[model samples]
Target: MFDLSKEFESFYKNKVVLPNDKQNDLREKKNLNISRLKDGLNEYNEENKTDYKIINTIVQGSMAMHTVVQNDSNDYDIDVAIIFEKENLNDKGPLAVRNIVTNALKRKCENFKKEPEVKTNCVRIEYQDGYHVDFAIYRRYKKENESEYTYEHAGSEWTLRDPKAINNWFKDEIKDKGQCLRKVIRFSKMFCKSRDYWVNMPGGLIQTVLCDEKIQNSYERIDEIFYHTMVEVKNRLDNDINVYNPTDTSLSLLSTKDHEKKVENFKNKLNDKLKKLDVLFESDCDKSKAKNAWYEFFNHDYWKEDTSNEKVQKYSSCYRNTEEFIEDLVNINEQYYVTVSCNVEANGFRLQPIKKLLRSLPKGWLPHGFSIKFNVEDTNVPKPYNIWWKVRNVGEIAQKRDMIRGQIEKHVGNCKQEHSDFFGNHYVECYIIKDNVCVAIDHIDVPIE
Candidate 1:
């Protein structure tokens, strides 16, 4: 049997988990926001003569648990619980408390590009660059015999919810399953992120629940863990079971009315991935097949090549040459075009330009000179860039004339080469090189007549 355990492990490490640098960047941003929130609240209380004291602020959700995936779009959603002293709730309702926090942030966050939006349960501050920070107001009652915290919910009601409790529960569960559990959850999340149907279907908490229940030390391989976990999740959804929050059992994670449709979609996506996993597992000794299966499953380019020995190459700079510059003045005001026509015979294939055929030339004939043009957009970079043209004979017929591939003038973008001597297929490639690195490339295949 084919084993993809090592591949899966590598994928998880490289693709699923966010890099340390990115994680640190997120942490720094979150801390900065937290500090601003505290300062904002303190200033608001002093300005309005309100006794609303910000006791503490706690980071919750995937940010705290370290299960967040690196989003290319920079839409990382952060959840922060803004805990206030119990005295703040003695005279104010949930909405009032929420508004106080929201107003404070709006007044204090003058440096932000956009104003903070007051949502039902949290104040959302969106940054121009992309990520957003959500501040959920919570009133902490530290009195003896009734020490607890109540969070704003539904704009008016105060609900008993503990963000730290859920985070702690997830941490304990991860400890029990060893480090693999976190990897499994992150991999599952990565799978969800790879597809559109599963994007918003399975949330972080729901995925955590599924992994905790299904991946009970049954298998050691990452692929097996993924398969079993997804299978169990599908079974649960098929049976119309509700996954409750570990912190609050009464609150069902899948409580929306449209959850049935969402669950059905999740099941369909899971089934498709499971089929691909089976294919990879059965593709023993077939490295290409296994890689293709993984590519299909992950829908990412990280698995496309082996890069263990490859060194990183950095280009100093790159720019495009404007089309008008190359088309009008560069070509000496002469219009250039290429035409291709193909004819298939029993023994060989022949390609010809329409101009040659229109002239009623003999069979297996070729054009005397083939002109190819290259151009690019305008750039602010100073001049003196090199342009190179590469032509190769790619036809089936052997003993054809040699192809030409060489550098042209900096301002020259047109290539009028002799093609009448060759009889087979040909390809022309153009590149703009700077500092020994190619900044732009274009290619076209030459067809024989």
Candidate 2:
């Protein structure tokens, strides 16, 4: 009666530490290979003489930043972006340029009796052990009124630079090329032990954006965004708390340390306020009593103004409702993950500890013979979705579910969304991918309002 699934996952993480030397070495070898391949491209370019030029050569991802190296023992891969330029919109000018390079590299590697480790474009090359090289092509630009107007290869986005302006906006931060890559590497490691999550999630666009000094350096409109994000994650995780902790001693408990710190900080900040308040010694009799106290405190003009007007209010707006009587299962993802899907898109689900929410939400204020009404909200379908929940402690998980469904049904009598029975199996779609390859990981919740 062993759960093989959990066992394998535990084994995989323990085995992964850091990428060995083989991780970076293939990058070195790839340089030699690219050099050899480039020689042939130059010959082809000279023969064609079509006036195409290599505009920029950028090395992106872990290898480029050097945080991760090539390890022969582990699976390592490298990526390269080779950018160039051409004129005709209809004709395949750059594609030809790309073809010559890719074809030449393919031919050279063919002697090894294998197709080149690559994709369609010549600028992009994949190396052994999960690394790749991307070649970027810059379309030819035109000089307009003393300004150089260069559109991206795709032509949808264009860059117009003033000749005199080198825009060292990040000059203080990204002084040199290596520093830029190093910063990126440091940020990339923040998300994963190395890049395993990137493989599981794939499309490391979030890492790239976080590494960009320009964005990091920007101070305007920053605080405004961060506060809202915290509350959003908290609110969403409050629901769908179905994640299990196995109640086993061997495995660690949910990361209560972080949660402890947060709660402690709040308690400390509120200590003085609690002291001056009249009901400091109020006993925990029922959730209903606590709810009454909290409501009374907030409803008072002085207390409301002190809290309701502050920036933290945005995040704290729903704090009481979320933690009132509920224990939740939270999925902490890499910074990039939360960055994109953010508010509604962060992944993982919370298991309501349904019974706990019911009993606790009442805050010790349960009326023994009271009947509860239930209703549903139409916005619960998922992202672009938000939920307002309060787990007023009911007796049992089954009882709580029934109570909540009844309440929601009363709330949504005309919404056409049915008052439904609880299904044992469900997947919470916290985050989703829209247009971009990057994902929006989300969570599920079963909240009582």
Candidate 3:
């Protein structure tokens, strides 16, 4: 059987997992919001004299499970359960408890960019920086010789829920299956993020169910495991089957409106991904092809190779060569004739003054700045050669001030920096370096005031 386990594993480690710095940043932001919520709730309780009080706050969801993927857009969603002490909850009702938490958050975080909003189960606090926290309000109480947590729903009223139990179940599954379970879940979440139809899919709950039923081992090839899981999930959704919360038997996880359309879209997208995966794993030597397939599957730029370092290296080499070539050319072709002119209105430096080179600036004019254009007047020099510009300070003091130095494609180049500081003669040199040898050179003394 064809296998791309090594490639998938590398991709998971390099691309699927969130970087430490990003994870820390998300954690720090989440903690800050949690602190704000706690302070706000405490002040609210003291001021209002309401018996409703937050007893505990617990971090739940994919964030707590470490299954989150790196989101370059900073759109991270964190889940927190704000457990309240059960007192007069039956009389106050679930809506009342949810509203209390929402009001407290709004009062505390009045300065936040986005106002706190109420969802079916949680009070969402959205930050301007692209991260949001969902505070699920739950009332905890001892009833019938057991402690239970109750969450609110829009039309159904209070429903039995144990976020801690659900979190424990995920944790236990991860433990039993090893880190592979976590990796698989993260990959699935990333897959969802890649496609538009899957973006609104219930990622966390679906991942949990798949881990429990589909994935059998930690050592299985990731592409194989992911494909199988996708097929199974698509099948279940196509059949209109309900996925139940492992912790609460009565709670159905798939409760989105227009379930049939969602399932159809999901199946279509899943087939596309499966086809790509097939091409990816079918060949071991064509890693680039596989990477492209994966990129198409996810539709994210994070899968692309980072060429920043390569660009820096190339520019550095070109810069060094230009400098050395200019030095050599200046020494060899001292007799070469080149003309340099400056135009203030056009903001250009002209060499061999073309008609376009406006002579609007008077000599010694240095107020608005100018560009330096240079062309080789020598006919012996070959055509289509590279040109470089170098500026040096030459006065009685003879101190070399910093100047903008770069290679120009044509015979014309611009001085990126203005000559405003000194009123003296500066040497502007242009050179043509051919085959690692300086073939022609020209120099002009530019007066700057």
Candidate 4:
């Protein structure tokens, strides 16, 4: 709820301004990336003709939105939509032109590298230098009887609209001309990693900026508000990570110099892409769920969830002996042994240590909620797909000791909905230890966004 200038003032107090040279270089790079993409589009046009002209490329993302960046910034890549007219994309015009335009890009991107190794028609066509170009074939729909413009989404095929007409459509609301409020939101999110910060900071900053009288009126331009927010955020980043943690040096035996160079290169790439907004992830990933997440691999980020490749068989197996199941569960839950033993019935047969199903749910559906879809795959299941076993819920987490933390996927067995209350919704596969006993795990870091 803090006001903008006040927020900026507090944020600024913690920031260390970059030397003019560095700032200028960074700024210049930002402009250069923009130019590169623009030039590429122009080249695309000259080489090939389309029904609709690509009027302008508007970049969306972090850099464009003006977020707080640290010394170690990454290229967010550029996201550009090919703006055209509605009438042009049809059996003959823009749709056909799209093919030619896409071909034009096959030439070269950087130093002889043809980025965007893969290209598809309707979806986004992404490339290097951190650029994600989307052909948003727009059109002003109408009949030959009357020529008026109406808008629509070009379903997975080649579609069209006018260059001026198309650009005008988006310009009205999502215009780049101005709107500075976003910068404040960016700064506050990095500080608090909360979207709520954005809503609150603007009112406060507007109040403070108005107090200056001279600059008060400029508030109408969103970019002005944005630039101001960036100025403050940049300052904070400088004072924070760079100043403290003496041991947190970028130097290493592997040529600290080389690493530093790559860091800058990466930062540049990130910044350049960021300008387009493709790199704009949900303000922050909710890894909070990961605090208690289990460490199955040296670096969990290294391995991915390959669930699509898996075909899990669901079957119910009541342990032939209840005590034996409990005993095995106790052993696995209590000890960190490499493996454990169990017995159960599945598919009219008996098997031990059942293999669970790993699902590939729709994106943003990860226990991360409705907006984030992860590509985690299933692994660690022994051969012969089905493992039969019977068990009970360890019960709700009662205290810190009860909740074990690790990423888990909901595993559903053959049990019908009426068979188990856990049927319809898959419970989080947890990796926590309660009372020194191994437990079901849930990652804490996956952001709710």
| Candidate 2, position 431, lDDT | 26
Tell me how far candidate 4 lies from the true structure as C-alpha RMSD in angstroms.
24.7
Q: Could you tell me the lDDT of residue 244 within candidate 2? A: 22
Q: Tell me the tens digit of each residue's lDDT in model 4 across 403-443.
A: 22222222333121111222112222222233422322111
TM-score of each: 0.64, 0.33, 0.61, 0.29
Give per-model CA RMSD. Answer: 20.2, 25.6, 21.6, 24.7
Q: Tens digits of per-residue lDDT for model 3 on 310-346?
A: 8744543332222122321222221112333432333
- Greater TM-score among 1 and 2 belongs to 1
- Which scores higher on TM-score, 1 or 4? 1
Question: Which should have the higher lDDT, number 2 or number 4?
Answer: 2
Instruction: Please list the residue runs of candidate 2 whose C-alpha ends up more than 4 Å from where it truly belongs after superposition.
Output: 1-27, 45-56, 66-77, 87-94, 110-114, 117-123, 128-130, 147-151, 154-199, 208-449
In angstroms, how far off is 248's CA in candidate 3?
3.2
> What lDDT does the true structure give each of the candidates?
0.60, 0.33, 0.59, 0.31
Once model 2 is optimally superposed onto the true structure by TM-score, how far is the C-alpha of residue 211 displaced, in angstroms?
8.1
Which parts of model 4 have CA positions greater than 4 angstroms off? 1-52, 61-72, 90-99, 112-114, 117-135, 140-148, 154-184, 191-449
Q: What shift in Å separates residue 109 of candidate 2 from its native position after superposition? A: 3.1
Q: Across residues 148-209, which tens digit of lDDT does each residue of candidate 2 receive? A: 55544422233332211111222222333323233332323332332232233112222232
* Candidate 4 backbone overlaps, count: 77
